[model samples]
Target: MGLTAEKRSADWLAQGGLRPTRQRLALAGLLVGDGEDRHVTAEGLFAAASDAGEKVSLATVYNTLRAFCEAGLMSEVVVDGSKSYFDTRMDDHPHFFWEDSATLTDAPKDELKITGLPMAPDGTEIAKVDVVIRLRRK
Candidate 1:
């Protein structure tokens, strides 16, 4: 896409309260218009930026992702506690992660339903729930 397209996307994001800096805009453009979903870690996003000719440091990517999450432009997925993966989809849904390839894909909502949990601890209720169904080639 051209700079105009980039600027337009930035404008849409800015309307959502995100200050789309150049790096942020570049990252935004990458995360969208690809015809597929994305699940990128900080390192993954950094490499992608470089490949896309977007000059950005790893730290900058990390910070920008945090800002994007805060601005509601992206969703942070933490399937593992050690590292977090950024997801662009904001809708409520589940995921299917391929363990062999470490690829994350969306799981159709109708395919599953989780309910009837025992209960939360005293004085605590469900804050947020994430379900990632892992898969491997059999």
Candidate 2:
């Protein structure tokens, strides 16, 4: 990786109050080095790390992803209960889950509209709303 990209990776981790470990730097580089938003699963990230000769274990990848989520570096979007996707874009936006190819992409925020939501119970208040529209090719 180029020096600029490496620095960016390190800086990102640092900004999130996470130590820039060797493995984290590598994974961060893969996730955000290109300056593009994407969604990835633990298995997929492990495979990519292996393909890139990262020498990281699948368990490590899972742990790293969880850490990233906890640190607010990424958001975990759970689909179908069993499967989850980690997204690099940190914003209040909806997503489109392509059922045919099992891919997740951002949905246009302007097009999605919600009229009413049930009031929170007791002293609680609404935290956030997640919208995932599933799509399939006809």
Candidate 3:
């Protein structure tokens, strides 16, 4: 038999080393209940919560998302100085940002290659590199 929504949420949270608080469970239900990968912004998630009759604040959404990222539950994609998206898939991959539609979609990671990356600062070590290819309609 398939896992119930509550059980699935709890298990997912536990896998990420997070306690499944009521708020977290509610948000997680909305984020991953369908079992499909997605990219969402804080504002978008808050709106979704409201649409789903979840009484969660925007600040809470942001905080929860950050916590989830820290717990390795999701990955953050920074499109620019002002825009960020949280990706449900945690594996290293590239994304395409559609400028006109303000949407993000995955790029085939196996098809991408990075070369000639500059060295990090003297005391700093390089972490994972994220690639976001921005596109616009012709």
Which candidate number would show the highest TM-score if scored against the true structure? 2
**Residue lDDT tens for model 3, 28-116:** 98878767789999999999999989999999999999999999999999988789899999899999999988999999999998877
User: How far is 127's C-alpha from truth in model 2 (Å)?
Assistant: 1.7
Residues 27-122 of candidate 1 have per-residue lDDT tens digits of 877776443467888999899889988889999999988988888777887866766888888888898888898878889988888877768999
Query: With candidate 3 superimposed using the best TM-score fit, by how many Å does residue 125's alpha carbon deviate from the native?
Result: 1.1
lDDT of each: 0.80, 0.92, 0.91
Off by over 4 Å in 1: 1-4, 33-36
Model 1: colliding residue pairs: none
Minimum summed lDDT over a 10-residue window in model 3 is located at 1-10
- TM-score (all chains, Cα) for each model: 0.86, 0.95, 0.94
C-alpha RMSD values across all candidates: 2.7, 1.9, 1.2
Candidate 1 vs 2: which has more lDDT: 2
